[model samples]
Target chain A: MSSNFRLQITNLLIGMCRGTPGLTAELRELGYREQWITSGFPRDVAGRSHPVMVLASRETRHSLFVEVAPGPRIDSDRLLQYTGTTAVELRRGTNLSREQTETYGIAVFGLTEHRDTLRESIEESGVRAALLLCDAEGIRLDVNPFMQAALANIFRPLLPISWAGVPRWIPFDHESGPADIAAAVVPDVVARLLAGETRIDIAEVCREQVLWKLTTEAGKKRLRASVRGALAEAAGREMRKYFSVRGRFVEAATTSSDDGVPLEHRILRIVSRRQVQLLTRLGGDDRNAEDR
Target chain B: MIARSRHHLHDYLQGRMTGTSAGGTAEQPPPGDTEPIKTYLVEVRGNGVAGRDPDFSVVKTLRALVSEPYLKAGFPARVHPARERGLVTIEGRYRGGTPVSMYADCRDPRHWLIHTLAPGRTADWAIGRMAAVGTRLSRVSMPGQLLEKLAGLGLLEGLILSHDRRQFDEGGGYGAEGFMSMQLWGGQSGRILSMMSRERSLSDSVSLSRVHVRYWPDEDDRAASCLAEIDRDGRMVTRGTSYEGHLHLVKVFRRLYTRQIENLESHFRVRADGDAGKLVGRCLTIRPARPIGNSARFCDIAFSGTPPFRLWGVPAQTSGSFTRVRALDLDVGGALDCEVTPEFLRVFLLSGTSANSVVRFLTNLQHYFHSGVRLLDQDGQDVLEL
Candidate 1:
């Protein structure tokens, strides 16, 4: 997966949970810090390490580990090695039990077929766990109403940021996984969460946010520059078509005419060496006289 | 008696044969024969290869020389450009219908020819005028002394005394009293010095104006002057006059005062008021209105505003008739009434409010309108669609 795509997903997640008090507190209690680093090797006081991947956490504990690889798979050994936490659990095809959620906080696995089951378990337990789910190119899974409600509460309203191009709103009824869900629901959730009212429709909020971003100056400049650049490039190419190099001289064929003059006669005339010398001398004389 | 009669007939016949009136009457002297018999003469001048006929390359120069003088003298001269390497003819009539023909060498300056195509004192006077013009041209070609002489004659409006840095005011003490004094410096790098009232301080016994303008010729050989207006707090208030603005003022003065010393004296005053209405009109008419945001409002007159906000309000009237536009800031509750007259557009801000917010709103309104943004009317309907 591309880093930009990964970053976008990460940002969506952060934006959704950043302003939600309950979600932030819950994550904090569960040891999920903001912008937490997950690395195989560690270094000095700054917690810098090689082969590091960042996840939002609380203190030294992480509540989420987002994986955006092509295939949906769980490498439990690698996860355990990097995290260096024995409490980490790899839940495969089954949903987390109440006892499992209470005991283990980190879950690194695929969420394709287990979305409904997981949603049910989360609703039953009422405990938010650090959930990392891989559903790359997986079939659309149903989102339970309970999980939906939880997400709606956790997400915060978002202000328009510098996003170029017009917003493309995904169809509301279309089945989507965590990434799509985060993108669509987070902004509305954030808005509702800030407004303390859940009456606002998530779809409408999402569409409005898109419109807001499109109208921003930075967005407009980006779009205009893109269009202008394309046009200018086309014009430049057309201009170059008539220019040709011939031996020691570059000849530009006249493709335009003015004042009833024929194109042949309108070809730009080159100044001769003698004329150049004359002009130089004249210019020099004027400069010298001005100096005096 | 027969022989005497025959001699008279012979004289008559001889005069007739020579194409003269009978008995030499055609060549007879003027009625006042005692008066000096003056012959009217006119000189046609040209420049380029002194003795060669003007050709295609030198036609423009010869044509200019031949016709410019007559045109300057307020006569309509018809010029015939040389078809071949020969003479170019300029024919015109003097103010009193005295015909004149100036034949100029197409290839040479020295071979210019002139002829008085009519006979009379009027024709002679016209010829003399042409001669005087030639003399003036020659004098102009001499040193700067001629210009000084012309200035003395009140023909040159702006003649600065280089030594004393003072203008030669033709009307010695004209426009002397005022809150300001103006001195026009004349030279290659012409300067116009405007000394006006400076801000007075507690330490100073008397308030006096100082010469803050310094004009110098720039790279383009154009005169540039900067005007610094300082406030009471000793801070520069104005943007310091632009070179173009100085050039424009100079041009206006030149136009108004050309060859008229009295008008020059009365008009180019440095008083505080200084006939500002007329000056504003001239300035507005000459320069294109400055683009203020996107608003259709255009202003050329410079008016004072509160500190940090100079010329904030623009009084713009539509091109045709008088329509008073009241610009109300929806957010700030500030209003400015724009009165449009046939001569000018003037904006007046309502009292009891700071103009800063209102000015900003107006500027933004202009921008929005210019950018094709639709603005909502009082009824919240999209009325401004342009």
Candidate 2:
């Protein structure tokens, strides 16, 4: 990518989220200040009054993010002040005067995804930290430090995780959850499809699906099971496609059943099997695989 | 990786400039102390490695001070290289039980604090921490490169880290030796702790938060730094010197290192390497002084060779210094003129005499502790009781 793109990505992922409220003092002691960060302001900065980032001297380790979302275009007046930022107050009736309306959404995912990113990164580069574009286009996965690809590329010879953690890629609703949000406007999805109205407002649909999925344990289980089955089927299709290469192959001198199998078998046995196993374990538990 | 890490380090050093969030000041020097003492309050929690890159990690910490009002050049007594030179020496199992290592001459302690983390579990853990702070580091260096460079230099080992600048001949010089430790930081709260070189460039003014350091160490790790001066073999290696084999690496204490600097109260925490039961290094802080007697010269020695030190089978260079060796004495926090005399070095370095263990022996003696100045008697045994 271009240098600016790389810089922006790096900053977005690492800055703005340097410290948790309680952990600021500890981070500062190590010489990393909050000023180095260019973006990713926390929801409630502990010290400031206007969501502005606190500048740390160069001797500091943790970077300073002026505003969690210090994008030249983004106005962060009301999103929320994080450890280094001040909160912005908004007047109810007044229009978002240029500066106040720039509140970009900067939600930290997982538990304290914001707390320890820098400390961990300094000790090891294998950790993953991501800053993504969170909008209706299915939530741009953005730059994720936690993923295998980036970690492997950055810190060669992937180091094992220090803690036992589930290998989870960023959760992406590629299909935009279910066709449920528009169901309110039109109860039957099939009827809407037949009536030539197929575009669904993904944001609304995902919200409804999330609510429905959270309604009861059984409902969530059912949803998980169907997802698992669908994932398994898709994986199977991929496996077949990989193995069924159209090119011809020369006969091997030592023809053997186990050793002679095409490369695809080895690929499936090693790589795809992992995908299938993970899907079975998670999908089955998360959704009602039996019911599906 | 070094470049990227350097970029982040440079940024961090800069960030240290604006360190105003510390909850309180560091521990103050005892009352009646003539000079102020600046302690770097650091806390370390992991077992990763911090490199000895003179150009990057080492210098960044000191260079960050350049932005401050402190004037680095034309330092008063001791003459140092343009770069804040440093040498790492381990006193394994010799630090009187503290597995403490010394990165001598470090003016800034926080940078040194980050370098003390040991190796292993570093790739994931260390890198993750850097990325979190938006830090990019340089690529890892390998042994062949180290060896080639060593061969060219007519040195011994093939391992030359990017930072090692020493030539490994009969006597090693001030350079990067492969036998160095890694730097790291870890914890639930994700606090930082590290060990840096003892040698650093001084700032006109020191960071207040960096002056006092404290940490609730892991008990075992506590012993990691609790060193024993005398080893089991009692071999006269460089127990306190970073370069143990060589007899040339020296720091002649012209005058007791008595700079009356301030003690900006700051607390710190750190982790020690797991190689317990082994000695590491030792550290002692000097209260800033109101200039003391001139010609008060002393020299520290070391050895970085075999037959003397092969503790873990992986030969390590002996590094560390004699504890509390008085370097200077001046009335700090005061406004007054000072004087020096030729008799200062004469009596300080003289052999013992009767009536009094001539206190003058101090000019060259590296004392275990400092209590003003004293002349010693003949045989260099008893104090002159002057």
Candidate 3:
């Protein structure tokens, strides 16, 4: 059981990293080391060793473990194992501003207007949860207190629903709510998937936020089962154009038209070509701007 | 082209080319207070491809000058190409109803000096616009350490630092409550800095922004009293300084600025390491008072506040005591990832990220997040020697 899970995660890591050559090459030069755990790792319920990949930097002493499709029992054990020893989950914690939230809305709207890929991806995953109802309008977490708390804690910083200038987790029972209460959310998830240096995994995002806080095995199980496929499918739909999906991970598509040009150089090239064209037309033909 | 010589430059600065003044002589000193020169020194990246003669576009820069953002905030300017190559005259009227004229010398591909005879505020407005236009152009950043070194050259006149505490004061109401700006003027200014250096609490609380000083070059024929006011963003205002004196100071300032640029570039330089190329990546280590991993306050202050910095972060997979975030710099169109621990913060810059963007980030980090922040390269060397 452990080998199968480990193989699945190892394959996911290989596919994602290979797709993200720009990020991979850059990270390598910076002295960050990656270790893939294929043998003698921690075990789960069926006595299978946990499959994980760890990326760490020696200078900063920073390490992060990437796991594949973590279930509640093993997730809880891993949380207990790393409890206080420099292994903490990254928290969003009301970091998403209103303008950023609006950008997400725009991105989602553009995606929906251009193609029907998002709706199809969501339908194919068969994810039916209160969170799935989220759109450009706002988030809808119409569920019990426990489920709402689980959803809220799992996705902080991205979905910033606030009151009196402080982030608050609201349980909206009806569709028509206060403007601020119903303010946009779901699009932020799309934005997160689209705007990043490296590919992100749905299972990894879930493992990062869910395990650290949940202590009880029952709570972890319930939270894991609550909205499993919904979030993953939502990520798939939003990242359709900008990213290429490989299993559970979504990597940004590397365009070949630019022929390996770095993103910065590409932008500069466009602006520079435009500048030269404009200068020639403006009749400013004097040269000698180059050093040589 | 205007002859790239000391004599011609002297004539230009003294307004002798336009016949505005008779120019200064050794026996007769130049009119003080009446002929103060404000120079907006800009760093430019190549906008042209390989084998291009005019690597830095003048017409593109003209459009940037008359760009909507600049015109709305500052003034309406008309740009005319000079008879000399890589030179342009900008004539405009400031919003305050003052006629302003500036000479932009773009002879060098690496740097451009925009000189104006208008008020200090006029220079500020123009420089601010240039900074806001695009990533191709930027103000030469003189970090706090550079400012301190410049102060040591001669008598210190004034110092200004905007120590930001907004992250600590999260719930504090709006207005000037978020930051504390302090300015000091007098001789022996090092005394206050010495005190702060000794007191850990005071030293770590404030970040340096601007420094005003008066220094005389060692050359006997040089101007005796050269008054200079330099800020962190590389705008220098000079008064009672001759053309030679100005060039001397600029030479020194450029050397320091070049050193900083090289240091920042070294941090981002990409090189392969043996077989571990797959596992290794660059890391810029910053030691701040508080840990930034998973800190909402750090994100709000660093990414959300300014352009070229306006980015959004998504939580990266992590366990135990480490937190990683993946973010895209929307303004500069670059992507970067950050890892945080209790003692230090590590930033992993990818392609598309510029050294200038990193400088701006480090500068802002010193102001808003931690004033005593120190940058260390992957090998644990000081990138910015503060």
True contacts kept of each: 0.00, 0.00, 0.04
- Model 3 achieves a DockQ score of 0.04
**Model 3 Cα lDDT, one tens digit per residue, B1-386:** 12234345456565431234434433332222134777777776554445765524775666565665646456887776665667776767678576566777776655677776667776677666665533456676565767788777667887887776655455652546456678888875667866765786566657788888777666565445577887787777777645445556666777676677666655453222222213223456677766555454454445442443455443322223344444444433344555555566656554335565566667767776667777776455667673
Q: What is the TM-score of chain B alone in each candidate?
A: 0.21, 0.16, 0.81
Give the candidate number with the greatest TM-score: 3
Q: Model 1: residues >4 Å from true position, as ranges?
A: A1-5, A17-33, A36-63, A86-104, A107-292, B1-386
Candidate 3 Cα misplacement greater than 4 A, ranges: A1-292, B1-9, B14-35, B45-48, B69-74, B83-85, B96-98, B107-110, B133-135, B173-179, B219-223, B270-281, B292-294, B305-312, B315-322, B330-333
- Where is the poorest 10-residue window by lDDT in model 1 chain B? B279-288
Q: Rank order by TM-score, top first? A: 3, 1, 2
Instruction: Residues A131-235, candidate 1: write the lDDT tens digits.
Output: 333233321223321132222233223222211110112111121222222222322222232222323332333333211221223333333333233222322
TM-scores across all candidates?
0.19, 0.16, 0.55
What is candidate 2's lDDT per residue for B1-386, written digit by digit as tens?
A: 01123233233222222221123233332222111111111211111236654434434433332222222221111111223334222112121222221122333322222221112122223222321211121111111111122122211211111122122212455433312322221221112111122123211111111011111123344321111111111001111111111111111110111110111011000111111211111111111112222222212221111111100000111112111111111100000001112222111110010101111122112111121223222222222111
Candidate 1 residue-wise lDDT, B94-137, digit = tens: 56354454443322232222322233343344434444322211
TM-score of chain A of 3: 0.23
Backbone clashes (count) for model 2? 218
TM-score of 2: 0.16
